[model samples]
Target chain A: MNLKAVYIHIGWFQMSVTNLIIVIGMVVLFGLALTLPFPGNSKGNKKGKGRK
Target chain B: MSIMQEKEMWTSKLRKSWQKTLPVEKLLPDTQPAYVASWIYLFGVATLASLGVIIASGIVLAFEGASWYHYSNVGHFINSMHFWSVQFFFVFMVVHLWGKFWMAAWRGRRLLTWITGAVAFVASIATAFTGYLIQTNFDSQWISYEAKDGFNSVGIGSRFNVTNFGQMILLHVAFLPIVLGVITMIHVLMVRAKGVVPPIDAFNAELGERK
Candidate 1:
């Protein structure tokens, strides 16, 4: 891969498309990790006993 | 205390502290409370997983030497992996840090865990800075030159010597990573010892008052 395919350019800073994609992908993944409810989420017994 | 009592005191105190703080079941719990299934809870493990990838890729890159990545495709690929892994690690860690902060995970006297994790985040940034400095490229040179004035003004430039390739490489590959790893281990152990913090709502409900 050409690591220098600049996708975003500021005055003295440049970000390659590849790196930008990776960062965007990570953000999406983090969003999903924070918002998505999984199967393990159950409103189980609310007993406060036996917890450490 | 008598001599025998004094001798027993050390061992007895050690064992007692260990048992009370981290019983076997708590250390290796098979079942977590349903609340643990929250997506935010997974970021801690995700950060760890990305760190693992970063370290593994770093080891491979180290064996090939620093400049080899510029010449060899495999080396470049591994280097890219390492770079991306570090990015992912930071992203996940920051999210986890924010999530825990919002949840007040430091509540319930897990202050040490929170402190260690925050320190680990700082150390990780330092490690990444050193890693960038050791890349042996124009970018590294520019970064080092740019960063030297900041360190010098802070009276740390002489000690850290960001421009020194050997020192930077050593810190990037060894010293900083070791410190980061140890802090991370302590953070995880504290989490295991203290158990996951309950949600703020649960905590407030348990206390019978809105906090």
Candidate 2:
């Protein structure tokens, strides 16, 4: 095609590459963080007395 | 409460409630004035005032006809006023955002206000983009086509047409205002609920030493 179309294609490619990379990085980091368990005294069922 | 009861005019209730008790100022206490930073907070009201001017000027421009707004001196003046109001709206909004940001004003139970305001900012930007396109001028032509590429690249082009006056103008005048108004109301209500955040304790300590 023409030089203008080529330039448009190049610009779009660069923008998509940048935006997609950023979005992917954010998602991966978020997923990793989500999978992490919080370090704490895990006392859930321990709080209750046994039923009489 | 019934939906119909909730729909009653606020002032109607205000008049009805006058026999009971006056309103309390501590909906959120005045103790957190420093968080709002005095006169600078007026910038938020100024932004709202400019939005008022925009709507008023826009309605007049619409009444005069779009082509008339382009050529008639009066229409042009009204359009210019609307343009300047948008400038003011943007400036005041930025200042308010900055002032709130530096205060770390979202501390305490007030994070929701900050989040809603951030959403409002996004909506306002969308509103401004539509405002630019609706003029259909040289600037509009360039910005419209150029902006669509960014959208088309991202795959939102199927839903939103950047060049269509019907969509953009309706969005600018109707949809955005309703959303912004609702969000703004929520933002204000949350702020009133949570009260302003306390000033930095270190700053208070410094001031105590000065005394």
Candidate 3:
């Protein structure tokens, strides 16, 4: 049940495989959060809505 | 009028300032702007919730003694919760930071909010580093020695010895958390006062509509 942790190394830069995955996942999540429509939010549906 | 009576009390001045800046309604709002309807807004709350979990788990670990986690199963579980919650906290916080940066959250006179949030992030890193140093293991020993050089280069090594477990634990569990909590509270209050920053386009559009 033991596994050696993998790491990515590029000359002077190094990061654990798990951490690199986490970073990539966070970036993807941020993108989705920006693009995805929020539930029950009809603000985007309304025309001429500018924070009134 | 008597001299002492004529002068306003400092407490009254403080209360007035608080009332003017952040009344109950503003501090705890029932409604938010339509633009706040985004999943990105949840990251800030997620980071807060993760901090709560970390604090709760850490309190349990503290009651059992620091090294008890290495021996007792329950202690180990609690310690694991603390560890994972910290990871989640950092992840959520970093995502929140990224989202805020893209949103230009410091816009509309909210610069203090952004500054406080950034300060909290750095303070959290220091707290986490201290937590690592107090782990009482070879990993901690290695980390301390490796970190000592950096701290020394910054002229803080004498004051903040990474190898000193007692000093590190105190900073980790007490001082850093209090500082981080204060900064976080100020950041949240500023956000509540100013409201969430609108998107750049929406903000410009609002100004255009006004004009």
- The number of the candidate with the highest lDDT is 1
lDDT by residue (tens digit), candidate 3, B1-211: 6656535788877887888888887788667766778899999999999999999998888788779988889888898899889999999999999999988889889999999999999999999998888777788999999999999998999899888888898888889989988999888888887878876777556567642
Whole-model alpha-carbon lDDT for candidate 2: 0.70
Give the alpha carbon lDDT tens digit for every residue of B23-57 in model 2: 35434343434233355556667778988898899
Candidate lDDT values, in order: 0.88, 0.70, 0.87
TM-score, structure 2 vs. true: 0.64
**Model 3: residues >4 Å from true position, as ranges?**
A43-52, B1-7, B203-211
Which parts of model 1 are misplaced by more than 4 Å?
A1-31, A43-52, B1-9
The TM-scores, one per candidate, come to 0.85, 0.64, 0.89
Please tell me which model should have the higher TM-score, number 1 or number 3. 3
Compared with the true structure, the alpha-carbon lDDT of candidate 1 equals 0.88
True contacts kept of each: 0.60, 0.00, 0.76
Each model's backbone clash number? 0, 0, 0
